[model samples]
Target: MLLMNEKIKASEVALTGLRGEDLGIVGREEALAMAREAKVDLVCTSLLSSPPPCKLVARGAAKQTDAQEKKAERIQGGAVKTKELRLTAHIEEHDYETKLRQAEKLLTSGHAVQLTVKLAGAKEGERAKALIDRMLKELAPHGTRETGIQVSGKQAAVKVNPA
Candidate 1:
């Protein structure tokens, strides 16, 4: 949590410089007074130090710093993209292998894969179900199946998320 002037509880707190180097421990009231006199805020920076730690900085400076840190983390961990691969009930073995390879590639690159097997009629729906089962088996090592095989209308689809 980002600590502020009033949230600080220690009667005495170690003061910190602008670069976060420790200055020394001082009475909390004096620190508050110094911040007030300097027309800035007194912020609690570290809670595990000997007397806890505080810093005097301009108002909103701590909040801005916190926001920047969070933004950096979000950017470091990129967003997950979802890629789809489609197949038919009577797909050739070579085409099935190609679809599996594409799905594996997407999963290895930290993307989710949506596998879809379209059925032309009720008669072909059972064959589509078998195809989906084979796909799940082949792709298990690359990703985890997030949902069970679901058949809606003429489509049987499953979602696989990166492991």
Candidate 2:
């Protein structure tokens, strides 16, 4: 929460001008007087600081600035996009080619690709591994494998990233 003007309880504060110029330290009363003189609000920026930092901001500009900062943080903290492509050990040649083209397209467009192969019988694990290896080899020009093939019970998977 932000404390403005008379609501600020600190006796003294490190002040900044409306244009963000440092104004050093001043008594809360003096800061409020300055704010009043400049037709702006004295808003406490950081309450945890030694003397609490306050700035002179236009009436609604403080809230607007805070909202913009939050929006920027949300955009910067967004996660990378990832695409998943599932395959079968007994896939036909044409279907395999189609999947390879899709993976290539996804990788070239900057999306991380998770390649997964489903296994049926115990002996099918080798075929699944072979299939995954073949796909990785085909995709080598477009992407690099981020994780080595992982086989768990009836599935094998790998992560690939754009080169």
Candidate 3:
């Protein structure tokens, strides 16, 4: 529900005294004016609130200061959870590499990834196992296979960790 570059609801912005506060009931022009004065982005903090609004503060500075704390919380809480990569039956080498890069990004973000290799129709035999083995080897340097690769109903799932 929290979208980047989108306005947040009024009820969600926290009051930070004079430094920063929620722009409850403030229009776009007023927000821009406040930002012009404070020299910060009018970012919306809480989205799930009535009459979606924004918070007036410098997002770059705030994020830089709190990045570590936020990362720590994500590492502890599994809420920022696993990301998945879906592989098709006829994936090309370049496509595979692209998917791998995306998987790496997910892993770097401290997210567990489920690489799903799906097979259908004619391409459902020896080729599938070979592809799965290759993918598993690629994943070996990153995470140990806590639960070995599972293949069921023409799909194999590889769970990997952050390298």
Question: On residues 1-163, what C-alpha lDDT tens digit does candidate 3 reach at each position?
Answer: 3322334323333333235443346555655556668767655545555544455556575466457676677677765466788997678999988887787677767778888888786456456667767876876665444466677777877677654
The lDDT leader among the candidates is 2
Lowest summed lDDT window (length 10), candidate 2: 71-80
Runs off by more than 4 Å, candidate 2: 1-78
* TM-score for candidate 1: 0.53
Q: Please, what are the lDDT tens digits per residue for candidate 1 over residues 1-163?
A: 7777877888889898656667788988888888888778888877777698788887788899987776556446887778889899999999989999999888877788989888888788778888989888888898899898898888999999876
Going through the candidates in the order shown, the clash numbers are 0, 0, 3
**RMSD in angstroms between candidate 3 and the native structure over all alpha carbons:** 8.9
Q: After superposition, how far is residue 17 of candidate 3 from its true place, in Å?
A: 40
The RMSD of every model to the true structure, in order and in angstroms, is 12.6, 11.5, 8.9
What TM-score does candidate 3 reach?
0.48
Candidate 3 has an lDDT of: 0.63
Candidate 2 residue lDDT tens string, 120-158:
877888899899999999999988998989988989999
List pairs with backbone clashes in candidate 2.
none
- What is the descending TM-score order? 1, 2, 3
TM-score per candidate: 0.53, 0.52, 0.48
Candidate 3, which segments miss by more than 4 Å at Cα? 1-74, 122-125
Q: Give the winner by lDDT: 1 or 2.
A: 2
Q: Which has the greatest TM-score?
A: 1
